[model samples]
Target: MATKPKSPHQEQPKTAPPADEGRFRDDTDVAVDAIHQRIVGREQTEPEEGFEPPPVWVWAASVVLLFVMGFYLGRYSGSWSTVAHEVESPAAAAAGPVKRTVNGTVVFTGVCQTCHQADGNGVAGQYPPLAGSEWVTRDAATPIRIVLYGLEGPITVKQTAFNNKMTPFHDKLTDDEIAAVVTHIRSSWRNSASAVTAEEVADLRAKYGVRGSWSAAELSAERSAR
Candidate 1:
């Protein structure tokens, strides 16, 4: 038997493709394989790189700041000496009593000047002159004892008589002040006299615990005997 050739107007038999077991398709017959493929229209962004170390300029600025701070400290730091010359001390230290080694010129003005007058010249016939007075310039004991205790009755200093009783200062002043006043008066006047030391005053005060006023007879009796 002979087979006849198909006509161009007749359609071929259509069969569905093999189905994807886990997927479904749309209402229109779109293939599941096409829907599962990578999308084509959207813009995809790549991830940025991980964290980086700080830039060079930041490190350089920190180094420059440290150098400036170090320079400033070295310039103004008292030549790096620990003397602390400007430290303020107590009022007693400034006054010269607590320091002990301090000079007596301040004590003379603060304590002795009232009675001895500012000029070392006492009132005529009332207080005796400290200037050129033999009692002060001759013997160390004369003025030291007199000032420590006081002087009573008539006393002749530089031939000027003072009958008024002078008050004692042992209770009023410290050993340092007494010594300073003695040193100041000795050097301050026109009279040439040796300086009295703080140690000397301490020794004398120890010998004479507490005593009453001194009489001219008592002071003059033992001149240069001390």
Candidate 2:
């Protein structure tokens, strides 16, 4: 078969040119490079961690709290030498010792009651009676001497003989105590005599020094001499 020639005005069917593989590859590489650069640049310009000072209010509050604690401790804490529970006030320590009155009845009850009996009516034949006894009411010095140096050998009290020995109270009792006891005995029961003084007992104690028990004859001799 023979082919007819086309008209000059009629256009030939258009066809795409063959792809350039090298050029496409180069364009893909260029796009990837652009994306990578964008990511790297963003990372490089990003903000970094840094130290920041605390707020002014926080520092102020810490200082205020420390001052409050120090003030509280100073106000409440006692001196270093003082104990917590046994803390004594300065006023109490400055005061002098308390004055106490010595009771004669209490002294007699504790010391003399055991041997002399509470009624002053001593044991018959064993202890001499203080009730209406001539020896006790004779003179202040006689009884004082008997009490201070004690009595030995036989002695007549109320016309009755007492052979028992009497213990000395010079070392055991103070001058005031001895005086008070002697006064108590002299005024008690059926006896009525003058009250003994601490000065009298003290003088006798000083004069006699320390001696053994005195006998009735010796006591009589001394009384006669006096």
Q: How much is the lDDT of residue 177 in candidate 1? A: 80
| Candidate 2 TM-score versus the reference | 0.57
Name the regions of candidate 1 deviating beyond 4 angstroms: 1-55, 63-100
Local accuracy of candidate 2 as per-residue lDDT tens digits, 73-183: 888776554655575678777886645555667777887777678998889898888767777777888888888889988988778888988888889888888887888
TM-scores for all predictions:
0.58, 0.57
RMSD per candidate (Å) reads 24.0, 27.3
- State how far residue 166 of model 1 sits from its true place (Å): 1.3
The per-residue C-alpha lDDT of model 2 at residue 204 equals 91
Q: CA shift at 61, candidate 1, in angstroms? A: 3.4
State the displacement of the C-alpha of residue 16, model 1, in Å, after optimal TM-score superposition.
87
